[model samples]
Target: MAWWMSSSRSEKGRFLFFVLPSLICWHIWKARNKAYYEGVQMRLGRICHDILIDMKGVVEVQFNQRLGVQTFLQLYEGTAHPPPCYSVQLVGWRVTEEGTLTLNTDGCSKGNPGVSGGGGILRDSLGLPLFVFSTYFGETSSLRAEVLALATRLRLCM
Candidate 1:
C-alpha cells in the first residue's frame, strides 16, 4: 500500500491510491461469497476487470466535471493502472549421490480450482537430465497438481 501511494503523488493519483484498496477488497470479498454460497467458480481476471470498471467510474464522476471528460479519462488510465514489474531469481540445484538418481517437480494453479498443471525433471547422479515431463491437469487444486506431478514421475521410474 505504501509502495503504491509513493509511486504517484498527483491529486487524482492520491485519490486512486487511497480508494484502491477498498475497491479491491470489496470485489474480492464479493467474489469469495459468490463462490462459497452460490457455488460459482472465482475468476481473478473477471474480478480485476470489475474493479477497473468501478475505479474508472469513481475517477470520472469525481473529477470529470472540473477536469473535463478527456483529462479525467487520461488520469484514470495512468494512475489507476500500476506499472508492470517482473523479477527473476537464480536457484542452485543439488546433485545426487553417484549411485542414485534425483527427481524434481512442481505444480501450479491459476485460481486454486482453475487451470492446473505440473512438470518434473529427472537427473542422473551426475546432474544430467535423463527425463522430463509436463502435463496439464485442467482445473484442479494446487495440492492435487503437486501430487499428480510426483505420481507421474513415480510411474515413469517404474
Candidate 2:
C-alpha cells in the first residue's frame, strides 16, 4: 500500500492525493528556478518542508472564509459553521400630493404558472391608509396577477 493510503481512509486520503502532486510540482519548479538563476539548490528534505509550509497558506485562506483555525475544520468533527451575514437597507414609502392619491400594487404566485393573487393599497398625501384590496386569480402567472392589480386600481379610481 502507498504511504498516504496507510495514513488515512477513503475520501480524505483521495483528496490529499489530488492536492499533494500540485504542491510538489510547484515546489520543484521553484527549486529549479533558484538553481538556474542563483546556483542555489534545495535538498530533498528542505523541498518537502517548503511544500508543506506553502500548503498551510492555501488551507488558511479557505478556513478564513468560515471562522478561525480552531473551528474551521469542525465540519469533519460534526460542528456546523454559522451562515454568512449580509447587510440590507430599506426606505419608507413616499407621500402623494395633497390633491392626489398614491396606489401601490403587488402580486404573488405559488409557482411560475400556479395559483396567484394580487393586492393594492391607496394612500393619501400624509401616507395614511385610504383603501386596500386583495383578489385571488385562481391559477395564473404573477405577471397576469400584476396586470390585473393595475387594472383594478384604475377602475377603483374612476
Candidate 3:
C-alpha cells in the first residue's frame, strides 16, 4: 500500500489510491457476512466483478452519467478507451442583501443509522465568514443530520 501510494504519478492514480482500498475492504466484508450467515460460497471472479460494478456506479454518480460497467474494468486493465470529456462549471456565492448574512450548512452520515455530523458557516453579504461551527450527532439518518444542521444554524440567528 505504501509502495502503491508512493508510485502513483498521476491525479487519477492518486484518486484511485485512496478509493480502491476502502472499496475493496467493504466488498470483502460484505462477502464475509454473506458466507457466514447465508452459507453462500464466495468466488474470486464474482468479487472482482462486484468491485468493478461498484466502482462504475461511483463513477456514474460523480459524473452524473449512466456509463457501462465495463468502462471501469477496462480502466484498471489498461485497455480502457478515453472517457467522454466533462465540462467544468464555475460556482460562486451570490451576495446577500445588505444588512443580512448568509448561512450555509451541510451534514452527512456514515450509514443510514450510523455516526453523523453537521456543520455550518455564517458569512456576511460580501462572503466573509463570521462564524463557523460543527457538531457530532452520535447516530442518525442523513436526513436528520441535515435537518439538525439547519436547525442549529437557525438557532444562531435567533
Candidate 4:
C-alpha cells in the first residue's frame, strides 16, 4: 500500500534498499526481545543465522551481485584504493646449508574437539630432512595442538 513498498517490490534495486534497513531493524528488535525476555544473549552464530534468514528473499532476487558490490564498497571505503603491484621476494634463505636448522610443523584434528595429531619435520640448512615426529592426543582441541607444536618446535630449537 505504501509508495516505497510498492516501488520496492517492482524495482529490484529499490527493493533491496528498502528491505535492508527493515531487516536490520527487525534483527535488532528480535535480539533485544531475546535478551530481555529469555535473559539470553545473542551469539555471533545466532545473529548470523538470523541475518541469513532475513536476507534470503533479497539474496535470491539479486543472486549475490549486490551483496558482493556492497562488500567491495565497504572495503574500498575502509582503505584508499591502492594501485595493484606485484613483487618477487625470496623466502627460506636461511635453509641454504646442510647444517642449517629448519622446522616445519602442522596439526590435524578428526573433528574440532576430537582426536588430534601434531607433526613436525626438522631439516638442516641444506634442506636435508633430519627427523620427522608426530604426536597423537585424545579428545583434544586444535588450539592445544597449535600450542604443542610451538612448544615442540622450541624444544627442538634448544
* Top-lDDT candidate index: 1
Off by over 4 Å in 2: 1-89
Show where candidate 1 strays beyond 4 Å. 1-87
Over 1-158, each residue of candidate 2 has an lDDT whose tens digit, in order, gives: 24344544344334445676899999999898898998997688778768666555555464453323332233222223223468999969776668787889888789988999988998888988899989898898988888988888889888
Question: Compared to the true structure, candidate 4 yields what TM-score?
Answer: 0.37
TM-score of each: 0.48, 0.44, 0.44, 0.37
TM-score, model 3 to reference:
0.44
Model 1, 97: alpha-carbon shift in Å?
A: 1.8
Arrange candidates by lDDT, descending: 1, 3, 2, 4
Best-fitting candidate, measured by TM-score? 1
- Taken over the whole model, the C-alpha lDDT of each candidate is 0.80, 0.69, 0.76, 0.65
lDDT, residue 51, model 1: 82
Q: Which whole-number lDDT from 0 to 100 does residue 44 have in model 1?
A: 88
Please give the clash total of every predicted structure, in order: 0, 0, 0, 4
Candidate 3 backbone collisions, by pair: none
Off by over 4 Å in 4: 1-99
After superposing candidate 3 on the true structure, give the runs of residues whose Cα lies further than 4 Å from its correct spot. 1-90
Q: Please give the range of 10 consecutive residues that has the lowest summed lDDT in model 1.
A: 65-74
